[model samples]
Target: MLWRSPRREDAYEIHELVRQCPPLDLNSVYNYLLLGEHFSDSCLVAERAGSIEGYVSAYIPPLTPEVLFIWQVAVRESARGAGLGGRLLQRLLARPAMGRIRYVETTVGPDNAPSRAMFLRLAGHLGAPVHESLLFDRSLFGPDAHDDERLMRLGPF
Candidate 1:
């Protein structure tokens, strides 16, 4: 797979990819376009044969430039397994603009084993410690029936 920063033109494909990857909250295509145009340094896309295979949306928080806040990770159904998700994250952190990033943070639903595992593997590779804490309560999602999202942080890498 060819990994690179996303372009505004890739938003629709990225949206479709996120839609296909369930348990992942799909944001509006316009939001995705903004991620490409404004946060291209932290977001990434994996394409092969002109088709989007994976994507990761992340940004360095303004108040915490050392932290890379990952918003979403999506891999096409056919691309599941073989560590594509983790690879996407690794490539994202390897970007020159991310050189100062010393921590990675993301919220994951309680039962999302795949996402949890991916982060754990990343922490292991980085030789960092993983810390979990309550970030968002289920009720905070209003009437959407969303699960509680807890913060998972890997730091000082």
Candidate 2:
């Protein structure tokens, strides 16, 4: 698989990848287009034979320039279990523009064990400190509620 930054043409493909990863909030394709075009420097996409197979959308938050907030990571079902998601993240953080970033931040549902484990493994591989704290409560989403999202940070890398 090829790991590289995303492109506008990959937006629709990325959106479909996200949809196949059940339970992930499917953002608008236009939003994905902007992400691919505007934040390509920080995001990553995995492809094989010209077809998109995985994506990880992230950006360095303005308020905390040292932190790269990973907004979303989706891997094609057929590509799962070979660590594609983690590879996507590792490559994204390896981008030259992200060299100054000292930390990674993302929120995950407490029950999402796969994601939770992935970050833990990343922290171990990066040899960074990993900390967790409450990020959002159910009330924050009003009625169409989801579980609390806990903030996970791995950093000073």
Candidate 3:
């Protein structure tokens, strides 16, 4: 498999692959594509035999100059375990535009071991710090309702 930057032409295949992943809101794919274009970030695709098998999107915000946020990464079920995800990450990290980046960050659900493991391994390889914390959202009921709104915060890188 080969990883390359995504073209506008690859939107359909990227959307289809993202749709197959659970916990993803398929309705927002169009907006996601727009975000990538607007930010000049990398939206990369992994292709095999002329078909897109996976993709990863990453952005380095000007406000947070030294940090790269890996927004999303997904691989087709048939393409899993092929190291496509790692390759896509490596390509994103190697981008000239990101040369000044000192940290890479991402958030994963606490129970999502595979996603967490992926980020951990990447963090280790890059020798960056990974801080895991409980992410809480405001709730209608009260502050004690934090349990229902908790997620994980795995960075500032």
Rank the models by lDDT, top first: 1, 2, 3
For each candidate, give its TM-score against the true structure: 0.98, 0.96, 0.80
Q: After superposition, how far is residue 13 of candidate 3 from its true place, in Å?
A: 1.3
Worst 10 residues of 1 by lDDT: 73-82
The residue ranges of model 3 lying beyond 4 angstroms of the native Cα positions read 27-29, 135-157
Candidate 2: regions farther than 4 A off: none
Return the clash pairs for model 3, or none: none
Task: State the TM-score for model 1.
Answer: 0.98
- What lDDT tens digits, residue by residue, belong to model 3 across residues 1-157? 7767777667777788889975443646676557557754567787889998888877776698787877778888887776667778877888788777777766575556666677777776676667765454446437542222233333333
All models: lDDT? Answer: 0.94, 0.87, 0.69
lDDT for 146 in candidate 3 is: 24
* Backbone Cα, N, C clashes tallied per candidate: 0, 0, 0
Q: For candidate 2, write residues 62-147 as lDDT tens digits.
A: 89989999999888888888888898888888778987889999998878888888888899989999989999987898899688
- Say which prediction, candidate 1 or candidate 3, comes out ahead on TM-score: 1
| Number of clashes found in candidate 1 | 0
Cα-based RMSD of the predictions, in order?
A: 0.7, 1.0, 4.0
Give lDDT tens digits, candidate 1, residues 33-94.
99999999999999999999999999999999999999999989888888999999999999
